[model samples]
Target: MQQIEFQLEHEFVELNQLLKLVGLCDSGGAGKALVATGEVCVDGTQELRKTAKIRAGQRVRMGDVEIQVGSST
Candidate 1:
């Protein structure tokens, strides 16, 4: 699967929050549901915490879609 990276303007961001920020899920509730079902992965590991604190340089995966946090440039 192709990996896409995101650039955050904050020091830390919630995992579920990131899903919405990146247009992954429609809403926070939906994001939470996705995470709760163990559908989300952090740095290649399944992450069940809806509010997982994620920072730059970390990776996230929802099935085949993988996202990484980093600067655009």
Candidate 2:
């Protein structure tokens, strides 16, 4: 699996935005669709909320990519 560390400038980022920020999906709409189809997971659990608040220390996985959210600093 490909592991990516995402640096957060704020306390949290929305799920769809995260996907786009990490280049997981081409667009926000695509990210939302991926989440709605149960293709996204938050910390090992299938996450369907497109706008779910993703904070630092959280792990998001979709297909073969795993993104680890971390502080910007």
In the range 1-73, model 2's lDDT, one tens digit per residue, is 9999999999999999999999988999988998999989999999999999999999999999999999985
Q: Which residue ranges in model 2 land beyond 4 Å of their true spot?
A: none
Model 1 bad stretches (over 4 Å): 71-73
Error of 1 at 50 (Å): 0.4
List TM-scores for all candidates, in order.
0.90, 0.95
* Residue-wise C-alpha lDDT for candidate 1, range 5-63, written one tens digit per residue: 78988788899889998888999998999999988989888999899999889999998
